[model samples]
Target: MKFLIFILGPSLLAIAVPLYNRIEPRLAGFPVFYWYLLLLIPFGSLCLYLYDRGRSDDRRPE
Candidate 1:
């Protein structure tokens, strides 16, 4: 699960650069590259929250 976090967050963002490095199909008159980066903000936050939640669970006395 921890490994999945890295793959989803950073890896996904990295993948987007090449995949969305285009100018067609713009959103709100913004290029795909720009919109992708904007959307990544929330996606990255969710990933970080998931990671932090998992990490906290690990530290709890069991």
Candidate 2:
């Protein structure tokens, strides 16, 4: 369902990043842990923004 997707999507991304680091040690200029850790802030914010936007868009005019 949409609700499940919205909640789980970000969590999956969070988990995958670390898994990716384990598979590929270097990303850009940093180690996988550092890269994933740095990405957490922006990725989390983006997920929250998308969740809010989806909720707003789902509203129907009354």
Candidate 3:
């Protein structure tokens, strides 16, 4: 479950360049690549947060 969260960013980013390299779709006049990267910001943050949450739970107290 947690492992899936960690891979979210990598998986999406792996295809992001090819997927959003075009300029066919525009959002608010912004290019698809621009908005696509903007959208990934929050998504990547969420993935990192989830991974950190899961990693912290595995810590061993000294």
For model 3, which pairs clash? none
Query: Which of 2 and 3 is the better model by TM-score?
Result: 3
- Of models 1 and 2, which has the larger lDDT? 1
Question: What is the overall TM-score of model 1 with all chains considered together?
Answer: 0.68
Evaluate residue 2 in candidate 1 and report its C-alpha lDDT on the 0 to 100 scale.
73
Better model by lDDT, 1 or 3? 3
Cα deviation at 51, candidate 3, in Å, is 0.7
Q: Candidate 2, 42: how far from true, in Å?
A: 1.3
Evaluate all candidate structures by whole-model CA lDDT and list the values in order: 0.76, 0.72, 0.77
What are the runs in model 1 whose C-alpha is more than 4 Å off? 60-62
Tell me the spans in candidate 2 whose CA falls farther than 4 Å from its real position. Answer: 15-24, 60-62
Residue 58 CA displacement from its true place in model 3, Å = 2.0
TM-scores, all models, native as reference: 0.68, 0.55, 0.68
Clash count (model 1, backbone only)? 0
List residue ranges in candidate 3 displaced over 4 A: 1-8, 11-15
Q: Write the residue-wise lDDT of candidate 3 on 1-62 in tens digits.
A: 66765766557684768888978689999898888888887788788887878778778886
